[model samples]
Target: MDFDPLPDKPAPDNPSGKLVLLRHGETEWSRAGKHTGLTDVPLTPHGEELARNAGPLLSGYDFVLELCSPLERARRTAELAGLHPEIDPLLVEWDYGGYEGRTTKEIRKELGYNWTPFTHGVIRGENSPGETVEEVAGRASRVLTRVLPAMAEGDVAIVAHGHLLRILTSVFLRMAPRFGAALTLDAGSISVLAFYREEPAILTWNHGPGLPLKPSES
Candidate 1:
């Protein structure tokens, strides 16, 4: 139920077809800041309220397609946002494997293991193949490829998780997946990313709806 404030400010505004990225509402795992990759947990009560409010916040955008992870949190968020998302497995979070349901600190001390999907690979657990950061990034890139053809027409809304979304951003920016580790997105937050002359530009990141400034105002 604790998270550090955003480490730094969001990127400056730029001109590009808007790609609205929404992280799903909070889960017990997310509220506790534990990795919820592929866990399929439902949203907490507070999370539902936030997701419902997002409908008005994002009503202005002309989203032609709603691509979402099959996980309950994301699908519920998309539904609350007044859109029906076509489930995309690639949109799911990184597989946490043995780390699922456990905090990073707890796992670190318990196993004396310090592994990051961006650097060290996820070990066997959660029925995941223990995918590495590069592998995860490739999956994200495939999603981008699926979405690009539709990008030229209307805005696209991606309802997904924090780490996976960050990885998707890296793929869009043509950066390695490890670079995404530096980009921190909050739970129930919205991010806008787009391209100018084929160059990636991040219009926003880690924006909280419950914060005084709404997404439209920001």
Candidate 2:
């Protein structure tokens, strides 16, 4: 387990450390395919185990910055994974407003038409007033502002929920925030993003245990 921390962050061979994203393991609502936001839910037992195993994937690096959503599920996952991340409100899941505890299927059935958070939007709810995709993207931008600079020092880690991470990824890649819909991130999954010839690129996507996570070729 002897290794260098890659102190030469900008060495010719390795231009900068990668941005590693660790999506929190499954929660009751997430497992049920419900829109989870604002509400702080705990992880299922299996989710705890998943987070334990996910630790090793990130063990090799010394992250200059580690951030996690304040929600219990995300915080629990970060603790289990030994991330010791700072609480980042910007990393919280997208505020689903009135849809907090409901599923897209149910909402669409009730509305009598197809709908999605990115397309149909959400209504004001008791817990949250709902946020537009643009608003979500703005938060993602703020996160990047702090994280991207840290990359020059070493890798940065983020332990958070799904939709927020995907939206952040889109913003990092200079894609429209709605592009997040095309990216599927599963609970307990790991993803890596870094620069490719001066442009942001995805080095790995939706990686999980029993899978390969070789060094980024970026």
Candidate 3:
């Protein structure tokens, strides 16, 4: 385990830490495949159950820092998981803007093309003014800056939205923000980021409750 190194900074000689990334449980928009950002939605009953079930998987680790999005859904998930987490604005979901509350299919139908947030980005509207991938990445970087120092002390946990966490994962690996398109995080799933021989690596990803834990490779 190693703390996240700053971009353009040299790695420390000896480092030990792990980042546990948790996506908040389901909401109506999430279940309906809508782009949810800044709506302050709550978790569904099943979603709360999912988060509660995740407690066992997370209980094994003693986290030095526990952070959750300021939004209700993420905070609620953290509560259900039995973790007292500080609210972090950086953990907020990507702003979908005009696309908010709309599915990709619905967007495609309106725009007459196969559009995605990763490439096409988003547009501002009367209701929601969207954000660029770079903007979200900037927030993610700030989060890393704050969390990396804490990581030196012990494991850290983050409960947030799907798109934001994927972007954060890309930032963690020093990959281009667009690379976030390749990572898919389901609601209530967990992913672990740690060091492998001084390099960042994803130890486990998209793990849900009741799934068998595979033995780590020697």
Candidate 4:
């Protein structure tokens, strides 16, 4: 809850701060390539293992603020990762609306054309009323407003969903929300955002525990 107010403009020299972004472990829906928004799903056993393994990767950092989505998946991932994070609704995943339980392939089969959440958006349905890319970007901006101040103190960690985190990163870099389409975040992966030469930059991205590293790098 404690964070600094957003400055009208960033300082020219020192970096603003670092943000450590993490996507929750895999869920049945995620494994099936279904759009999961506002759905409360638990992680698979393998997913739990993924989260546990991520602990050591994050244990060394000193975070001033730690937050996670209220969804069970994100909260559980944080716990498994050895982090006690506050719940932040703003960190929830994109509202997929009518596409809630469907995959792009299924949707395409129905629509007779390729469909993507990033460009076409979602149709408002009884079960799921989808959100626009711009709307998602707006929420991402609000999240930055809260975390930027905390970043001034030290690093901050946000455990959230794949789509939301990517959009958040795009907003962090002052890029269009659609640009998030280019960033692929795997389940239980960690990405780091920091300042380079006093400008926002990605220090590391989509690093999974299973990734191979050279002896010296490891």
Candidate 5:
């Protein structure tokens, strides 16, 4: 077969990147509504199944890189998702500090202050175990800035915690991280961010096993 040496092909149009953001599956803490941060817990058996199912659902994408939080839950979920992920600290969930392993209601009762990441931010003692909403947002922004360059031409999967991923989505769209408070990301759910001419667009939002895989196809 004879092939002609073609001239440069416009450098492939400077392809914009796609982000395949995946929230980790359920954990005992998650099921109990506890704030999971550095606590590092494993998924429930059902969560494991859900994570495994993600493989077939997500395998079709040509992801250039796979990243996951250093936390065990996120790491295990990434493993079950069938993607070998490179650990990135930026992908770690928000550090709940004193709130770790505790529920929102419990924290409110103890502190006498309504606490929420988007609302009150972190309440009390800020030594080293927890993170404020702004702190978490900064981490999300750092990851976003670093990953965007690598996203060109193909997709990138990031297996992480719900709160952090939500913040990341907001940051990627150039929105305030506090807006993530409005978003509800379920365990093992998948979201996608597409770029059109360097502009951010949500190709898909929170979706998972029972939902239609693609919007048009849905």
Candidate 6:
């Protein structure tokens, strides 16, 4: 259970604690390949099992600030994972808007060509207007401002959706938010963002329950 993968910081006193991301477990929409932004979705029974198991993987870290999206799926995952997290509205998923409940394949078929949320973009929805990738990046920046300080204090964990966390990872790495489209996160996965000598780096990514790092890799 040695989780010592992080490298040394450039400075001793200014060490920033790692940012641990916990993606919420599966919901009906997620299982069905539907876009699940803004709409509140509950976790499936198997999803609850996934959350409970994720708790053990995170038992090593002393998280100072634990945040979860206000969405039910994210909050329920945090709760089941034994995290008493503060509900952070900013951690909600990408505002899929017009595409809220539709799958990417379905959208593409309807449009008669390829349509991607990150690249092709989303229009205003029936309930609320969708957010552009850059807008999501802006929100990610604000979240960093709030969490970076806490990271310096101690490790921080966020329980949220796939798109939101991936976009946040891109922002943290100083990349275009749309770069998140290249990253894929599954339900009930863990990703760690820590410093590599004071510069941001991804320590581990998309570590799902079924995957394991080889001994030498760890």
**lDDT tens digits, residues 26-131, model 3?**
8877887888888888988878888998888998887999999999999999999999999998789998888888888888999999899998989996786888
* C-alpha lDDT of residue 65 in model 6: 95
For 39-130, candidate 5 gives per-residue lDDT tens digits of: 77898887787688777879889988889999888889889889998999888887776666778888789879876756776544455456
lDDT of 6 at 152: 76
Comparing 1 and 6 by TM-score, which wins?
6
Predicted structure with the largest TM-score when compared to the true one? 3
Which candidate has the top score in lDDT? 3
Error of 4 at 11 (Å): 5.9
Model 6: lDDT equals 0.82
User: What residue pairs are clashing in model 3?
Assistant: 1-16, 1-17, 2-17
Model 1 bad stretches (over 4 Å): 1-16, 111-115, 211-218
Each model's lDDT: 0.74, 0.81, 0.83, 0.82, 0.75, 0.82
The stretch of ten residues in a row with the least summed lDDT in candidate 4 is 1-10
Which residue runs of candidate 2 sit more than 4 Å off their true CA positions?
1-15, 210-218
Candidate 3 Cα errors over 4 Å, as ranges:
1-14, 211-218
Worst 10 residues of 1 by lDDT: 1-10
Write down the worst ten-residue block by lDDT for model 3.
209-218
Return the TM-score for candidate 4, rounded to 2 decimals.
Answer: 0.90
What are the per-model numbers of colliding residue pairs?
A: 2, 0, 3, 3, 1, 0
Worst 10 residues of 5 by lDDT: 1-10
lDDT of 2 by residue, 1-218 (tens): 11112122333443388899998887777877788888888988878877888899888887989999999999999899888989988888888899888988889999999888877778899867988877888888888877877888889999987889988888888778888888888788889999887678899998876532222100
Tens-digit lDDT string for candidate 1 (1-218) = 01112113222333334788998887777777677888788988877877887777688888877899998999999898787889998888888787777777776687677745566656788476656777677788778765665667668899988888988887777666778878877667889887765567788887767743222100
Candidate 2 local Cα displacement, residue 118, angstroms: 1.3
